[model samples]
Target: MTYVFNPTYQLLVLASAFAAVHLLASGRTFIFASHTILFAALTAVLVSHGIEPYQTTAQAPGGLWVKLFYGAAKATWWIGGALMLVSSVRLFLIFEGRPREGRLVQDLLAGLIYTGAALSIVAYVFNVPVGTLIATSGVIAVILGLALQSTLSDVFSGVALNLGRPYSVGDWIILDTGVQGRVVETNWRATHLLNGTNDLVVIPNSTLAKSQLVNQSSPDETHGVTLTVRVITSRSPTQIQQVFSTILLGGRHTLREPAPLVTMGEMDGQSIGVELAFRVADAGQIITAKNEMLDLIFRHLKAEGLALATSVPNLGVPLNITSIGSAAADPSDQHDAIRDVPLFAALTENELNLLTQGVTRKTYARGTEIIHQGEKSGALMVVTRGVVIVEKELGNSRIELNRLSPGDFFGERGLLMGAEEPGFIRALSQVSVLEITSEDLSKILHARPDLADDLGATLAARLDAEAEYGVATPSMRRPLTIAHRIRHLFQL
Candidate 1:
């Protein structure tokens, strides 16, 4: 007679209750990781007390009277233990910050656990010969493996990549094929990258493993930028290196710690080449820093009277000799510099001539401060040669506010409204500037009251930009308000 009630079945029910409790508490995995391990141990102990799951259903005593029920109990116990082992592995991975990365390893471990449990169920519950079943499975596994050889390669490659960790999420990497992007996610099959065009690129792990990769974000995020400039061999290379030094110094975006490197490269019959190497804060700053460096190169080249070599060879490099700026600019050249300024573009010829009458050309040695922060100046200064940096001092360090190239004007706030300068202007190299005093400005404005509108608007816009970039609190003062202030200040 088949027994309706069995003590062994009752024990299996109790074990199931414990497993339910563990599952219900699994939400607090971090806190319960240790508890899970202990619960796995307990399940293991209870499972061992039974006729080992390796036993066949026929081997279970008849006194239990229900062979089918005994087989199910054995399978349930082993299955429960397998589940607990998988949970323990998951819990450990969670503690190690998995699923973010190294996800494949966890899945592989869980799969192994399930495979073992399945094999045990077949052997103990169904009275199947373990050796025969394994042999059959081995053949099937071989057939499946051959069919999935490509997939297996990707799987193993992913495992290697995760373990090696050449790049992590958010790291910008450059591949051998020039596909560059920031790593967004990595999975068992492929890695996802957000490229510069903001498009998602999915690369299979096997292919990625085979290709050469460069991690730009490694060893800290500072990225090195190298730029090349070729110039006519009119000037000494040492002097050119000095000029390049000034160019690098004027780059507000380049890092100062590594020290900009200027190396003289190959010299042909026509021209010589120079390579400038520098570092920027990160990959994101590369474009901005490169643009700044190119602008500074042109400004310094013009200031030093050096000419960039023409691409058309054999035709001879025609240098733009408008003015050789190495020496102090004469009155005529100074007038041209001031006149070429966009701010004074609207002035009539006579009006521009009148504005230059009292303009004085001043030269400052490299590392000289043209104007201190909060200083009141009665003159408007325009950069005629070389570069100047507007810097805001904060505690021990200084922040670069802006860079002034040729024809760029400063000291306007102090000259126009008698207001203090917002930051200190320092000559990054031996720089030449044309200064127009308030006396000359007064005469010009008297002749043209309409000029106040342009000057005031320009001044307001500059202040607005400075406020946006620097630590200065932006004022609510509008350009119209500033134009009125200029009119009132100049008594126009």
Candidate 2:
């Protein structure tokens, strides 16, 4: 052990110690520059001690035995140095932005570099004939190639794939054999994939190179998703199209540029199939997107009184349901709907009657825009029947904010403070709404000044909640300073 401190061995021993410490500290054993320096230092120390490193025959400690030990040491040193140099170069290139080399290329290059260095060490350090080594290697190669035919095929195929650069890591690919996953790693033997179930799948590179693959992330992150549903043939095609379009447009991750397509498909028995096609954020989001679309479709259809024909035979007579939103809501029903709203809860019976009479009842069919984002609206819409989707248009895509059902109200800020609409409100079904305008609210406030405080508190609380969730509108911010704004808007 004291030999480690000798002048001839100090550099080699110190480098070895440093390399071991770096491996332990960093946990990065593949960083080969330190290993390369250690090996080169070992080679220099061994050469300085003796000329010949290996012996063909046995001898005393000072003669043949010493030569043989040094020869073996020299070979190991040179071979390790060559391997480390190759690895270091590959890692440097990778970090320097030449990612085309990848793992397969790095492994192949390392193997070839080490093999050549080993051959040179045999010929130069040990004085073996090159011709004999070549002849022997040729026979060994054939035997190894025959034994590892499948593995060799994978290696060559992996090289071809890396060079051709089809699908890279992080790409979502579906194989011809129905395997769909995101590419996590590509090596000489297999490519690793992370599937929807969070399981890792290892596929041979040879199989992937031969099979057809669809890379949903290649052209861009945008991916098209198609949903099919069967509807009763009794429903009008135009209304069905409108219903499906509204549902698609209201989807959270749905894109609006390509405009969703709703085409009538084949007829099946008593029902007709319709396709709702839309593009979402990416392949990874398709599952959640599909789930959202189905949920919306079920809710919207139920609200519109449309349903898929039952497989069970019905003895009852089929009622012919016609155009949606055609029936006008009765005044009494509108009055009842307004009375249910929490905002109008504080008003007296006479005040409520005045509001009910003053309110304008509007009907909108499916896909109708009841209110658009940024539009000036001084009226509060109370959903009397059916569903309305509140969404915000973000560039070319639309994200659903909330859904409104019967008894739910929106645009209170607009009615009280004269604020602009924060988002778009579209009818998802045959919808009826009772609208209470700013003028009607002002008339009530003039007669009853105490109601302004209740309204102001409610508005302030809603705005604060929206701001906390990062969805606060610019127009709604003014109402958050409740004292002055509410008094001024309501004329209190």
Candidate 3:
């Protein structure tokens, strides 16, 4: 090892050490950095030892055995230099932007570099004629190219796609051939996509190159959704527009910048037509946004005493939540909303009416703060119209905890346990709610003791949800602890 320090062997020893480090760094981030160092060391060693890898008649230095070792070392040095060239191309890609999309170009360049290095080794080390070799290889290339015509087309098409960057990995694309999916991988021959059903789809680059494609994530990630709704003449056109406007404002899954739109269409003797057009964050959010908007439509319509046209077509759009909000809610809207409440699903008809009687209806416009974070409210509130978003602040970031629609409940923690809210609740649109004071809710809990069991479990779940969103709460005793608290608070 001490010989490494001797001037005669120092350059060789340093080159060998750099090569070892480069090999050790393979498959890691340090490989590219280490490759550069090894390349420089190899170049220095070859130049110092009077061995030129590029010179066809370059002598290997010393005796036969030493010449043999020098030949191998010179070949290794050429390969190292090729790798350094490849590394520079990759570094250029990082600076050029779109490192991910430029991978195909980088790889193709690396292959060419290695090929050139191989040709150089043949001429310089073996003293072979490259002109004859190039001529013979041209004939073989034509034959292979003809045999693998389709594959070659795909390879070239992939190169074109990477250079043009029509779509990158993670973009949702739809081919004219009716194939729609998110791009998960792209290789030499094909683009792999993960479809909505979680199935992997591989399409040859040749086909993708020819087929017309719509990139849903292009220009931006936001995608538009259009829904047509028909309403009976029971409500005015102005009223319908106002309610639909509220839906867009309250939508949590939709984008805000592009701004949602509502257009009044032709009206017939049976009903009036309206189109609700909005843009969601992405194609993946379309269904969620639709469902939430539909629910809000029903709740708002029911609260405002508007009804869907009797002749409204099914249109293949499945209405998931049924049996409660289907009919027009006018004379007893509060009673029906209370009946549909999941928390009071098991309550007697008379009990529901009793709770409904005590509720004081309240309303708020868009952007109004309904419940402030850390505020203690002595009343229980149930949403009767529109939507509200619950948001919590954690240091510098503010996260939306949840969105509440009609019939959903809140303020239980304050009313039952007299605790502060885990987050602030703000009205996303024109909102209306039925507020039940502690005195009113207490009477109902005392009247129906069985309700204590259900409300307690529901309240515990609500608190648990808040705890998950950067808030702290006690280890709630699912139903029992909450029920006991209700009894103590209300003196039941």
The estimated TM-scores of all candidates read 0.73, 0.61, 0.83
Candidate 1 has an lDDT of: 0.77
The residue-by-residue lDDT of candidate 1 on 23-105, one tens digit each, is 66545364255445544554564455554554554565565546666676677767767766776676667423545675667
lDDT of each: 0.77, 0.71, 0.77
Candidate 1 least-lDDT 10 residues: 319-328
lDDT, candidate 2, equals: 0.71
RMSD of 3: 5.0
lDDT of 1 at 458: 79
Worst 10 residues of 2 by lDDT: 1-10
Model 1 residue 344 CA deviation (Å) reads 5.5
lDDT of 3 at 337: 73
Residue 127 in candidate 2, Cα distance off native in Å: 1.7
Residue-by-residue lDDT tens digits, candidate 3, 1-492: 011112236546756766676566554346667778777776776676565666766564467866666567668878788877777777775514657667788889989999999998888888889889999899899999999999999999999998888999889999998999999888899999998889999999999999999999988899999989877765678988887787676677877778899998988665787899999888878778899888777766666667776452567543232222555556246777777677777778888877777788888998899889899877788887778888887788778877787778888888888888878889887778888887777677888877777888887777676676647557564668889887877777
Name the top lDDT candidate. 3
> Regarding lDDT, does 1 or 2 come out ahead?
1
Predicted structure 2, TM vs. truth: 0.61
Supply the global lDDT for candidate 3.
0.77
